[model samples]
Target: MASALNSKIHAPGNCPGSKADARGGAGWRMDCDPEMHVKMCKKIAQLTKVIYALNTRQDETEAGMEALREAHQEELQQAVAETEARLLQAQGRVGEEEALRQRIQALESALELQKQLTQEALAQSASCRLETQERELRVEAEHAERVLTLSKEMLELKADYEKRLRHLSGHEAPRWDRLTKEGPEPKAEPGCGPEMREVLLEVERLRAENQQLSKDYARKAEELQATYERENEAVRQAMQQSVSEALWQWQEKETDLRKNFQAQEAALQAQVRKLEGDLEHRGRKISDLKKYAQKLKDRIQDLDVQLKEARQENSELKSTAKKLGEKLAIAKDKLMLQECHVTQKTGDMKTERVSENEVLRKENNLEACSLHPQQDQNFAKECPCTKGGTDTQTKKEACIETEYMKQKYEEDLRKIKHQTEEEKKHLKDQLMKRLEDLVKKHTVEIKSVRSSVEAERKRLQKEVEAQLEEVKKKSENEIKQLEEEKAALSVKLQNSLLEVLRLEEFIQQNKACPPRGDEKPQELDYQHCNILETQ
Candidate 1:
């Protein structure tokens, strides 16, 4: 019994009994059986070993679960990142398409504008050509009329000269015939000879004057013809030069317009080609995105299956841990019951006195032995609770963040809306002001244009009236001059007719006298010759 007591006092499992042995001494030790103490110690050792194996198995299972969780988290993060990247790419593509569409719309507008400009240019050119052509035709017609009028005037002057020459020739022919019928006047008297010589001298002077007038008239006609030809040639050259210059300017304008139009067309064509290529590339990218989405779907499905399997394994581990914990509790309860019976037996032998330090040490040892499983169970329980707590906290924080974002967004939106309204109002006011200003400007311009047009019309009318008055005055002056010339010619013709009649009367009187005698006839002829010469 003493050896058993010594062995019990030294055994690791009977540390609490050592305190009692120290307090009760040998008397308390003599009450306990050695065989029972040894059996209790062996049972405790076996229970501790079982507990250690359970704890190691649980730790290994937890380690495996932790690795799986980390892998799942990594996969989830990778998938999330990939999906986010794809979404961003899709958004970028959508933006590009929108931009391309806007560009196409702008190009179409520009093309329409170019077409309108070209059409306007063409219309203006056509109108300009028509006006120029009309002006040229009018100028040509006026020149033709002037040429015709000059030709008619020249023909009339030629006719007048011929008629005057014929009249002078007929009058001279009658005088010559009278001389011939008389068979040459006899120079029988001295007074007749002097009178005849004076008459011949006057006749020679009149013929010489007639020849000088004809030569002067012919020279004046030649000068007028040369001046007319020079004027016509100068007018034609001016018209040709003006027409050629206008044609060259018009051709230059047309070439410039064509070059600009062609350049615009080429640039637009290049833009269209570039747009088409971009659209094709976008189409290819869309197809690639579809295939990537399909791949993501497959990967998500696989991840879902893995998650389900992990969930099942976790549940199974939890159930196993619960069973093991229950079993350990029952074993600890049985060991506690045996220890209580041993303490009762020792209490009957003597007063059971336990030291405060030994009780504290015993409690600490019991806690240490059970701490692993209890802590594991507690940790397992706390894990979900902590996870749920963290999840709730995160959810709450997320909700608060979302609410804050919403409030901020609303505030910002309100501010933006207010700003937009202000901008709109300002723009509206500006537009209204601009519109009013434009209306006023246009109205002023219209009034000014109308006033200018009226003034121009009045000025043109005054100018035209003045030109007409000047033309009428010039025509009237020309008519008056022509009439005066006609009157002078009529007076000269009457004088010539009277002289011819007088000469005829003188010849008749001479014939009637029948040359009575040479002296009488010579005296009568001398009187007639003196009358003719004086007239």
Candidate 2:
């Protein structure tokens, strides 16, 4: 196009060159007709107008490029901010995840501790039950032994009484038999003798003695039966009372164990409630963190969309700048052609016009050279000097802003990390403190409960021992009294036997005297004499 425009402007027979000037080149003239000069002037005027329009378009392109560069920088800053925000959100999520894990671990540990405590408490309770059962068994065994001893003593006393009764009966039976065999010699007499009357009196005394012995035997048997019944009743009452006391003690111990278990349950429930509340709080935090992360993702998406728009606009501005550069080159060529035509008409403007043309040509050459490279360079370096200056300045500002944002992001990340660390430590401390307090409290409670249980058990043991001793002493005293009663009854039996022997000897003496042949054997009524029925 420049070659065609040059051909049109410097064509033959159109204008006079400097070499063809009249008067030795001091003045120059256009060899063209006046009409052609007018046409050329009009064309120069039109070219000036086109150049002016191109200059205006170039200014507009520069302004647009500058604006686009500023917009791009702002978009870059926004993109950096979005990236930083996303990074921060990610970091926050990581921290939250870690915190949640820690909390879960803490809760798990607490649960394990609680389980262990519960197991220990159960073991302690089980051991306590075993001890109580053993004690009860021992008490029952002791009671059985005591009862057996009392029964044995009673049986031995009964056997002894039976042996003594049999011995006394055997000795009296032979004596009675001998007395019966020795009958009195019969002598017939019409009148009664004094001896016969005396013999009759002795027989009457013996009959009275037999009746008295029978009455005494009956009374002693009734007394012995009554004493035995009373001793049995006393023993039964003592056993019943001991059993009742043992039962009451067992009930009290059971109640104490139930109360302790209830207390432990309440404490565990409170701890569970606290743990549930902590879990709920953590859940809320997790939910909030999720919401924040979602918001950050949305913001990043928005920033991505905005960045694409900025890039699209930047490309459009580059294309517009390239088109404007082409238009400027064309306008520059037209202006150069206009100046050549004007300089050919006016001799005085030759050197100035040539210099101006040379400068315009150089600019055209540079623009043409940079045109292809502009596609790969993003038009930043290959752009017009003024445009390049704006691009470089804006780029530097964007870089500074990005670096600042990076530094700020790093600082924020550091702060967040520090805060998260502190939070973790604080939470851990609180958990540890709570766990320690719970452990201490549980230990104290267990100790107190165990001490109380031991004390109660000991007290119950002492009380039972004292009751057993009292029962023993009472039983012994009753046994001693029974033995004394038996001895007194035995003495009475011996006296009765001696009286019988004396009566028998008197009868034999009277028989020997024969009462003067028993002048008259008075009719003795023997029907009134009867032996007593003994048990």
Clashing residue pairs, candidate 1?
none
lDDT values of the candidates?
0.54, 0.49
* Cα RMSD, each candidate: 29.5, 27.7
- Candidate 1 lDDT by residue in tens digits, 1-535: 3344345444434424445553553343343344444554554455456556656665766676677678767877887898788789878878987987797678657756765764575466456545644654564455445435544554555466567667756766775576578777643466556655665675677667656655654455345434534653464455455445544654565566457646655665565556556655655565555556545554555455445544554564455446545654554454454344444444432342235335545865777677887765565575467445544553354345434543653464366448646855775686567557755765675566556655655665566457446645654564475356446535644554464355456535644543221133244345434543543
Best by the TM-score measure: 1
In terms of lDDT, the poorest run of 10 residues in model 1 is 515-524
Clashes of 2: 0
Q: Could you give candidate 2's per-residue lDDT for residues 1-535 as a string of tens digits?
A: 4345545655554445645432222222233233333443554455456556646665675676567567656866876786687678768867876776686567546645654654464455446444544553454344334434433443454455446556655655664465467556444344635555665565567556545644554454345334533543453344445444444554454455446545544554555455446545544554454455445444554455445544544454455445545644554454455445454534434454456557756876786686775553553444456444654553355345434543653464466448646855775686567557755765675566556655655665566457446645654564465356445534643454454354346334434543211121121111001111110
- The C-alpha TM-scores of every prediction are 0.40, 0.34
RMSD of 2: 27.7
Error of 2 at 247 (Å): 14
